[model samples]
Target: MKWNSSHKAAGQHVHQPGDKHAHAAGDGHNHTHGGIFGKNTELIFSLICGGLIGIGFGLSFIDGIPPLVSMIFYITAYFFGGYFTAKEAAQTIARGGFEIDFLMFVAAIGAAILGSWVEGALLLFLFSLGHALEHFAMEKARKSIAALTELAPKTALRKDGNGTNEVPIEALRKGDVIVVRPNTKIAADGVVVKGSSSVNQAPITGESIPVDKEPAPEGSFKIEETGKLDDKYRVFAGTINGNDLLEIQVSKEASDSTLSRLVQLVNEAQTQKSPTQQFTDRFERFFVPAVLILVVLLCFAFLVVDETFSTSFYRAMSVLVAASPCALAISTPSAVLSGVARAARAGVLIKGGRPLEDLGSLTAIAFDKTGTLTEGKPKLTKIMPLKTDVTEVQLLKIVVAVETLSDHPIAKAIVRDGKEKLGGEDLPAAHDMEAVLGKGIKAALGNDAIFAGNLALFESLDESKPSAEIVAVVRKAEQEGHTTMLIRRNQEYIGMIAVMDTPRAEAKGALEALQREGIRKMIMLTGDNQAVAEAIAAQTGITEARGGLLPEQKVEAVTQLAQQEGKVAMVGDGVNDAPAMARSTVGIAMGAAGSDVALETADIALMGDKLSLLPFAIGLSRHAKKIIQQNLIVSLGMVAILIPLTILGIATIGPAVVAHEGSTLIVVFNALRLLAYQGK
Candidate 1:
């Protein structure tokens, strides 16, 4: 196509009503899926067109038929590099929308009008190349989310009465049993009815460790519904099952599965623009029109200075090329995408660019007591046998027997401790076990009746029987924030087991790192009593503690802290804490590998139990913000300096085009540097 004819036809920029109607009617166009060449076809075509242009420019310098060949090459280059961009510009111009592409098209046309066909063609080639590179970067960043969908199985082995049949994941309904064979990915969220093996949950949770999975609890699993992580009986889709036959009853539909929700979160996050991005978009709307008007004014000023119209127009074109906002427009998104992708690889899910930016500005952080600063599992930290008559080993055996049937965290800790201490000694069975709802458990061991519970339970049975030593030990355990259990056999005081949710090994170091990153305050918020909260806080180096907080109270505490500190982040992992997380500037969920609520509610999610990634995530976010600022400064600064040079006649179209495109390339590479970021 001839450039003049095509340019005039393309100038009708607006989409006709008929075109919209055709699109609504599902016309044969596949905008989302370009034929066999795929979405990057334009980029590929542009690169080829750019190469042809280079050949054509080389041919232009030769004599005879080579110049004729160069003409052919230039025409092909114009069709490949400038066709689509000019079409878009014309459509926008028809709608009275003067976008950056229109400014670029106008500049290239002016270069051609000044008898600089090579310069104009080169301008299109470089512009298309930059556009392709930016699109490729964004595509790579978003592929992380797309990868999630590829990890899950599309079909499942549904179990029948005697035989199993293969079915699509969507066909499997809630409560439908599915058989997962060894080394297979789970098809849906479900509870294992029969199985014993370690399942790799890295796909969903970002954890490197494979968690042990067992059959569903024989007792009431709902009694201690702490979170998905606490419920080891459950498994998620996209996770790999180990070398064991697992009979799993699907609990969620295909679309409602954890992997689906994760992909949804990432997709939504990508669409939600950050503040810097929003500003850049708004600025570009005016920036392009302003540049066009400025170029026109520059042409007029040159004419008044007695310059020829061609000379003035050429200078005006140079200014337009130099002052284009392409670099500035792409600065924030490139850095944001890179930073988010890097964080995702490290098992930190930053919901969007907005949260990624907010994380860098965090002045204070509030951590939930149970699962944030400490390991959510309570462990037997202290074993005190107050009864001098009974052996420590004997007392532990009784403690284990009495608490064996309970699924409480502390009870499990006691059983674990007992098994370790017993050294293969089979404990006598506790017959006729009875539990007091909020107090303790009572069971019969041989001829003796064992009572195991709290001080309240001990006092209710016989308050006056407590000796001074027993009272002191109980008080001391409570003071240290341990969950104490009193033991009595045959109506006589025996011993007590003190359990505390111990601090995670990385908690202290993570907190220290946060302080080094300029975090001024770190507070612990918990439903646990003040003593327990303070104990964990002291161990983790938190600045303060707020205990005995209800779900709403935690929100209130977060709000108050945010008011005091400018920006505050709340970290939690339970469904109850979702409200509080929603109230904070940035809500971070800990060990959110399996919980759907935690994943949806928090702005940022840590996939594993390690707290060390918290500081690393913060540091990465700050670095991302810094990189974006640097990119913008470099891009805008280059344009600022280049525009003046063009106006003063010190620079021409060739140098201006090179400098403009060169700055954009530099800005893009600078943002890509975040992909290689390594946290200290």
Candidate 2:
């Protein structure tokens, strides 16, 4: 995998300006504050006020202190602890709605008016402290998103003619050359036109291995027999440039890079409300008004029954405060933020909350075989001479000479394999080379007319002769799971090269894991032939396989599967797979070996090509969804039980307040469990 750390490094630029000043300001504020108070002086003042209020209450029981003096001390304690909350509650009410802050404020004021001054002061302090803790928790949950914008470098090494200059990354533009030195972050998306080294791309691809890169064309620099890239390759931002010094020509500016787009999409997704959040919002819209009506009915019933107006009004106010449903409103966001943070930490970049929500309900998964299951890189598997007395070397040299002129994947594989046998660089040069799209190529190699391709290439020849040996070679290669390309010299059959794409080592294990996780239907959709696709699928434990699919055909397969299953996820890693990936219920990109189009189009990206993460991601989402459901049920149940108990006089004001706060705390804690979620 080519790890792009430039994006991660470039993201740090988002925080560079004023970061030191902000940190200094934050530290200064921290030192001045003690507990929830703004300063140590405030804490001392609160203590003094509380002590004086206790003394006043004690004096009321005795007969020496004046009642008015006692009242002054009591007022001081109320002002010290509950004053800010009272002001905030009034502000919230003026905005036409209420929150938990308002409820706690009203309850505290009611306690003070009823001569429970100590309880009211304690409630104010504890509630304020709780709100602070919740604020800290939410900030912690958002750390990953914040970190995304904090890792970019403030300055970039820009290439200026012969020398380099350090400039702000924001000043970078497309086509500008940049120098990325050892251990430095790449500032923009570009090609390494010079130098070679191993890069740590864990931030981008989620793979821990350092990828070795060289200044060669993408398809020519084959790291493994199964790993290579096509021509016209482009590396992305946020990748780390390793030990070698790289002179890269920037393709995209800092803001338009992959990492920047990912951040933008993630933020957009966060703003989109899921079904559960929508339900909660609708319920609260009606729930709050219904609670108000119940409070009115309680007051009317008390007056009709000749009860004291003061006691009835106080009870009704408590019920109204207790039924605000603020906790329920906060539960979904907390869970989603925490879940997204955890996923980013694991290297699976889910674009938004909606994709995460959809992942939980996935019942079926469709895979594109070429680049998704089997490694897309083709290798020369066999060589068969067609005519009598024709040597393998002679045939290979001609095939390589003609193929070297073309840039197709299969052509590259043949040329690469034949180049090894030719030994030196003095191979025959081909002239008049012409490539036929989806067919083959026509070239002249030193007085020999060469035609190399599939059967269509031979059919295009007017005077080409087919041999029995060539037919047998083609038949045997196809039967043994290989794609054969025919080579002709001077209208006579020469030889054939059989190429095959090897399946991934982890393919079988990943397929079984998906099955174990209750993926009822697993299918392979490929552009290859039926024989090749079926052979690969069977080896990888995929029972059902569809072959000979074009890019559009792959999309149709996903759509058909979606009709049969509850939800379908398409996993692929090719430019051809982008449409299907977008069409599926969930589009999972095999980022490690996938094209940029696949990576950008996929909703969920498996940074590492380890397909096992698919099942793990699915299981994790299901577990998170279950926990969310459990939390919602617990919160709503508590509300249902408490509202009736309060109305029927079975629960008093203090107990109702305690129950409401406890339920809120419980739901919030339950939602936090998603952060610790791990799947088998």
TM-scores vs. true structure, each candidate? 0.65, 0.57
lDDT of each: 0.70, 0.63
Q: How close is candidate 2 to the true structure, as a TM-score?
A: 0.57
Per-model clash counts, in order, read 3, 18
lDDT of 2 by residue, 306-365 (tens): 688876876676666456454554455456556666776677766544466667887788
Highest lDDT: give the candidate number. 1
For model 1, give the 10-residue run with minimal summed lDDT: 1-10
Give stretches of model 1 more than 4 Å off: 1-272, 298-308, 337-352, 407-409, 462-465, 550-552, 576-583, 591-594, 600-603, 607-609, 672-680
